[model samples]
Target: MHLTRTWTPPGAYDLPGSLAVLARGPYDPTFQVHAGSVWRTTRLRSGPATLRLTPAASRVRAEAWGAGAQEVLDGLPALLGEGDAPEEFVPRHRVVAESHRRHPGLRLTRTGRVLESLVPAILEQKITSIEAYRSWRHLVRKFGEPAPGPHPSLHVVPEPRTWVRIPSWEWHRANVDSKRSDAIVRAAGRSSRMEEAAAMALPAALARLQAIPGVGPWTAAEALQRSNGDPDAVTVGDLHLPRTVGYALTGERNTDDAGMLALLEPYRGQRHRAARLLTLTGLHPPRRRPRRQPGDITRL
Candidate 1:
């Protein structure tokens, strides 16, 4: 489809770096292939051009090509590195900036939609990430839109209505319990409101999401970590983060959320960024039990 209209970041949408940066998402073909969440394909066009991005109600459509491709791809880090931290947290701005510079592609990923991030974050609550990604992949393949364009394998996230309307049989099929399903449905019910939250500041956006029935600190932090590139919104209550952070900063294997926060306090607004760097720095606690074991409740 030819877009004749205009945008503030005109041509900015066509650039991969800018899109990846703005979205703080993964752009690697491998990631696109392995990650069921990424829906990508080339549009048959006459001449050379890079990608195009359109902000839909639930997805960002991207297309790209030619010489401009490199320019577009180069801008992602700079774009996503822009943080939404409050002025009060500005003291650590340099730290974040430096950290991003130190670890250019670290934890910054540009997932296509806010709800995509939100739903997974909710699914991960009090559970393993293996379980969360499993549930996400299962549900999307079952209920999501067949992504537009040639790559039929690409699937957009399930619409809020779809989540709210999912049958119990499908939930069992996906191994999602009532709690996770409930949170997803409840969040979906407020999707319209959450979409509006995108325009709000980080704190406000997180606050609105937190107002939902089941979205709590971990989920909100997870959402904002990408939604607004919020620096201060650390994912507390994580099972392994404390130990990871503790080991990275203090060379110890023990730390609670509070202690992790304290250890990361020096970075403040950029705590998440630092955590991202630490993780990317290969500083995780030494192979704690062969990563996390998956729990498939569907078997039970």
Candidate 2:
């Protein structure tokens, strides 16, 4: 069975940017950019669906196949950021404002799949994105089901119960240390509540997710950005974001998380949007020295 949907963008729509936000890496098994279209899979309350989204002038064309086709169709608009109002944000920095003016098409998307975002966020705790993405690709390729329809290369993310069942040895094999793997399992144990929290108020949802021992502000914010499109969701505790945001705003490379928050306070409800704009502007604190990128332990 197939389901089709179309969405006209409220402004300039960069389909790749809209979809790239969902993909963890170029090697991510669950999401991929291919042939000028986005191919992805997710498990809905009904079942798993694989979708192909093709970009058109001022419109997005989507087709879904599988048991969850109808649900994916229903969620397509929100996934395309139909619920987001980028205009609501008032940038506090000259760089941010200029980038916002230049990139009117950049919008925060809300997929409302809490577990889908949460699990990967867990894998990312204290690890470099490359390590996290590789871990995600390995685990999903091993445990996830083949996406339905003709796109067998795609994989539907496993249910929370499956995540919980992955053994400690298996996590080690995937190069995911005990801490991050355990966090994912613990969060998966209450998958129903987590998914429900996605629909709750943003603060309430973050609080609910943070109830898990390993889930923290940073992980919760990352999950909310993807699942709820929380514009104010500022990622805390990142190794580079504080410096990046700070340098873009204050020309200071010595800034920390507190400094980043202080600088972002002027934007208050629109901090994430402001930071995103600054990031798009290609402004950065000059590199004094190359920081060591995280190496994959699983290959060692």
Candidate 3:
């Protein structure tokens, strides 16, 4: 459906800003799009939208198209950023400020809740990205809703109830093992609690997620990275992050998680921000390993 909405000034500022940071697609699946399963593309759509401020004559207009547009746009500030942090949240302040300085048009977003972010993060565990994304596309398209507006081709994430009911055969088809699938099911069982965490303080939110089965430090951190924009919430058990960060910062080409943490010590609460910098600086260390191509699971 074609709809229209208006944002006076500050209210809508967070919406468009979020789209920029979360739209990197394949480069950052944790934030960009919500996955239903292993083989679908879901995007957030917006109604007729515009932004204007009282002090200036210039106006900015926006239009988000596709499925999940409302969910994403409505939930951006909640998932990708925070509006209530104190000025003394020094790490966040510095990170946001630095981000502003370096990327003037940058828009931080909140990715909604732990459930949506965590499911994919878990799927990504102990596997290559191609594996993770394939699993996501498969699961989502099989279970998710059609896009809400004019863009029926898009899909919204499956509801928690829907996630809890997925069949074992389907999971196997997507290359999802019982461990990750169980974790997703458990999280979905308490989906309401996860949604409640969005209104909580960062630490409290992290604690809530940890209480769920199979969601530990790494998964929580990954979820919070998008849902809360918490600069200090570093992924403790990521398979590839430590080496990537280490090589980018020290040129040593390898390091453990502890070493990566130590190297990022100066950034403290802004570890994610430091990582984002290393990512955008375009300084990837030369690859020493063979590249893996994606397997076509659909024909299996």
lDDT of 2 by residue, 71-124 (tens): 999999889888888878887668888898888888888898999999999998
| Tens digit of per-residue lDDT, candidate 1, span 84-180 | 2222332333434454455332333332245656877787788775666677677766776544434435555566777889988788778788888
Q: Candidate 3, residue 98: CA error in Å? A: 10
TM-score of 3: 0.73
Candidate 2 versus the native: TM-score? 0.96
User: How well does each candidate superpose onto the true structure, as a TM-score?
Assistant: 0.70, 0.96, 0.73
Say which prediction, candidate 1 or candidate 3, comes out ahead on lDDT. Answer: 3
Q: Mind giving the per-residue lDDT tens digits that candidate 3 earns over 1-300? A: 222323333422333344444332453322232221111223323322111111122223323434344553454334324442323233323433454355443334465555677788778777777788778876776787554433334555677888999998888898888888999999989988887876677789889999987888888887777666676777778766787778766777677899989978877866776665555555556777788766544465
Error of 3 at 232 (Å): 1.8
- Give the clash total for candidate 2: 0
- Ten residues in sequence with the least summed lDDT for candidate 2: 291-300
Q: How accurate is candidate 1 locally (lDDT)?
A: 0.58
Candidate 3 global lDDT = 0.59
What is candidate 2's local distance difference test score? Answer: 0.87
> Which portions of model 3 show Cα errors greater than 4 Å?
6-102, 293-300
